[model samples]
Target: MSITAATGVPVIEPASVPVLELKGIGKQFGAIRALHGVDLTVRAGEVIGLMGDNGAGKSTLVRIIAGNFPPSQGTIRFDGREVHFHRPVDSRAVGIEVVYQDLALANNLTAAANVFLGRELKRSFGPIRLLDHRAMETRALELFQELRSETRPHDLVKDMSGGQRQAVAIARTRLSNAKLVMMDEPTAAISVRQVEQVLGLIHRLKEQGIAVMLISHRMPDIFAVCDRVVVMRRGEKRADKPIAESSPEEVTALITGAKEAA
Candidate 1:
């Protein structure tokens, strides 16, 4: 029920303070309502699977959380404090990191560059400032080592495999010391070996007490790591339960809106 951090930090589960909580989360575009009354809770050191069919409002909800736009009809609570995300910067400032399927790495940049991205370290020389590449690379290597990844810090993202790119993307979150990471379809298109690596990386994140929101259609991926699942259908949350008490069949039925028949 409790896990220690990667550096042996005693991780408090945030039992009284969930990392993120949503209530009556709704989104509307013109006359079309994309989401209605959606509720979700993400706890520290836990991996939560967000499963829903296409057109099920999963994307809408994620965008809202990522600060793509403000929710039209709900409240967001982070670390027991009420908050509003009007822009992506606001979300990032609060240690909320979202890694989409694209990985979002600059293809031409080195893994270390991408890890720091906009928040690069600088060295000063008589009022002149330059990027401290060596420091960034060293830090990047340390992060990868902590994740038990074999990725090279100086390697170009374009040259890396899909799984390797994902590793770098996930490492970027650690640069900001993120508390919660939302992975959108993490294992969509990758080799079997790559999938295993990414799944192992998720376990590492959880061990470090970083809450994870894993949004994937792959049942095996969900079952492999998720502690709980929230199933959505037609823009509304249909079921939320612990992994131990819920089966893939039950989740599938809830997602497909076939619960009654099943």
Candidate 2:
């Protein structure tokens, strides 16, 4: 299926096969089991918020999905094909982009340079080719404008505000043609206004038909943008329900394993 935007751009819906699927996933560290029998599905154009307290296996699960760690047992499928992401680059190859809590921007690099950090466009000059700074800056500006962000390509990362920095990180993800964008506590240290800006960017990602997996503990943030919420407790999925069908209190209880199905 496909959706047409108000601007008449045809946004292709995620394939019938989920963009990302984890079935009976399990991960262990030494004698400790970080995650066990956890299953997740992320579809195109939908935002799924993952909620759990610290040590609830949110980090382990994300690491497994992002290819930072391999699962001990389970099957992961992307776009209908079984995939084993042995490294971060492997994950990126399949259009899976992860934005960690740190936002990973180079403090000294300009916004455009950071956006194309490792994937720089270069003019062909055999082995002596130089970086195409002009092209990168132009493209970065276009992407920011497309997302309706106000940040400029020439801005220094260290000089920008929190929200602007977040926008730049998100723009970098878009540059990779990411089909699934996973955000880990994207609004953690920002001001209220910055939080709003980041949330708006999440919506824009959905508008572009990208599948988003959001990891956050903030109930208001989750409820504001997520179509569905998945609660995890003791490294297991406790419940998956539509945001509107569940109350914050009920979800919190589920996360803490304080309530069972009535």
- Ten-residue region with minimum lDDT total, candidate 2: 1-10
Candidate 2: stretches off by over 4 Å: 1-15, 125-127
Q: Rate the local accuracy (lDDT) of all candidates.
A: 0.91, 0.90
lDDT of 2 by residue, 50-166 (tens): 998899898889888899979999999998899998999999999999988898899999999989988999998877999999999999999899778989999999998888888
Model 1, C-alpha of 232: deviation from truth (Å):
0.8
lDDT leader: 1
Clashes of 1: 0
Top-TM-score structure, candidate number: 1
List, residue by residue over 23-91, the lDDT tens digit for candidate 1: 999999989899999888888999999999999989999999999999989999999999999999899
Q: What TM-score would each prediction reach against the true structure? A: 0.92, 0.92
For model 1, give the RMSD to the true fold: 5.5
